[model samples]
Target: MQKVRGVVARAKGEPVSVETVLVPDPGPGEAVVQVQTCGVCHTDLHYREGGINDDFPFLLGHEAAGVVESVGEGVTNVAPGDFVILNWRAVCGDCRACRRGEPWYCFSTFNAEQRMTLEDGTELTPALGIGAFAEKTLVHSGQCTKVDPSASPAAVGLLGCGVMAGIGAAINTGAVGRGKSVAVIGCGGVGAAAVAGSALAGASRIIAVDLDDRKLEWARGLGATHTVNSKERDAVEAIQELTDGFGADVVIDAVGRPETWKQAFYARDLAGTVVLVGVPTPDMRIPDLPLIDVFGRGGALKSSWYGDCLPDRDFPMLVDLYQQGRLDLDAFVSERIGLDDVEAAFERMHHGDVLRSVVEL
Candidate 1:
């Protein structure tokens, strides 16, 4: 067993604590990763707040990049010394989705069979099956996706979660193509990445909608052609006007709120796609809209889970693009912090003060 420092939420609505936890040696199909950096994503905060479930004493970091320290028997996909980004969706090839050749929707994703625990022998639930805010983490070997070691860990790790979600929302889920017009609501990490993805896809126009001017400015840097202050203007109207009065070819709702979702619903042209990438709380519901509008709109309405990404296929390609300087992955790193600062990062994220605050181990 290896004793390592890790961030844990002991209860709902309580601040996370850095505690020494015992990480067992990798069992079959498992691997141990020495985490280099992990991003403080909203999901981590949500897990701490009990938004995900009632699983207490949850290990809270998921977005991470690390070096493989060891692997257990039956693990051949990765080896010791490999640099990788941790992914939650470790496709199980025999599952229905994988059998259908859609591993991105793999019905049976893998995680380590063993559990990490506190010194007192309490089992700890790792967030998203990755609890990476620690100095080291144990995961299924399939969760580790090898990438170029030359890339910045802080920047590339974002691809493990929010960044990947946004890009996949545009390219994979929305099927954004050359000359298409795109609009992304909520100009945060995921939304801004969607704009960048749209631009990379050769979108003719990319509209970024957000309430914060700072986020809008950051969105412009990431290739948003137009910015809309939703608090000051009607987001749907602005998007429609920007898209030649017919609305954009694709509208992505990154905010996940009913109001923002409604805006995205009406801000697309007839037959255009609307991708809802933002996660909604269990208590939240889609507000009532005219049933005729859904039928008459004649376009696809879809939800993007983890941007519908296949990590094995997408991670390396995106890392290559970042190396080539075509994609500004660095723009997403607003700050670098220590593990102790994650609570502060949560506050900054809540206030829209930073795109991402990476915790360097």
Candidate 2:
């Protein structure tokens, strides 16, 4: 076992603390990563707030990139010194979903079999199966997808989650095509990514909707062809006006609230797609709508999970795209701080002050 400095969330609604934790050498099929950078995702905040569960003393960080430090007895895919992007879905080939040829929906994803423990020997649950806000972390060898080492870890690590979800929500789930009109609601990190993805996919008109004009300006930079401040105007009406008065070909709801969802439901052309990539709370419910609307809408209502991405295939491709200067992955990195600044980053996140605050290990 090796001791590494890490950030840990001890209790709900409490601040994260920097401390030393034990990371054991890799076991069979596992590897140890020397983490270079990790992104502060809202999901980490959800875990800190006990919104995910009561797993106290949670090891909070997931979206990350690193170099392989060591491999287990049977590991072969990556070697020491290889750069990699860590992922949660280390898919098990024998699972039902895998057998059905949809490994992305694998029911039996794997993580480090051994635990990273506190100094006092208390076991710590790694958030989202990846405890990455540290000097080193242990994960299944399959979780390490090798990518271009030249790419900035701070930029590519964001691809491990939110950015990937947004891009995938557009290019994958939304099935955006050449000349299609696409609109993304909630110009946050994920929503802005969706807009970028649409532009990359050759969407002719990419509309961005949000309450904050600042975010709308950011979205415009990210390839949104039109911007709508939803607070200032009816979002559905505004979207319709932009797409030849027929709404957009695809509408993505990055804000998962019922009201925003309703706007997305109505802000698409006939036979167009609606993709819900935003997350919703447990207590929220959709209001009554005529069943005829669902039938008359005449298209798919889809939900994107992690952009339905296949990491091994997608991560390397995205990194290459970033390297080519086609994807502005670096623009997403609004600020960089150490693991100790996570609590403060959360404060900024709550106030919508930044796109992403990355932690440099």
- Whose TM-score is greatest here? 1
Q: How well does each candidate superpose onto the true structure, as a TM-score?
A: 0.99, 0.98
Model 1 agreement with the true structure over 110-227: per-residue lDDT tens digits:
9999999999999999999999999999999999999999999999999999999999999999999999999999989999999999998999999999999999999999999999
Model 1 residue 121 CA deviation (Å) reads 0.4
The alpha-carbon deviation from the true structure for residue 293 of candidate 1, after best TM-score superposition, in angstroms, is: 0.7
Per-residue lDDT tens digits of candidate 2, residues 135-239? 999999999999999999999999988999999999989999899999899988899899989988999999999999988998999899899998889999999
Model 1: how far residue 74 lies from native, Å = 1.1
Which residue ranges in model 2 land beyond 4 Å of their true spot? none
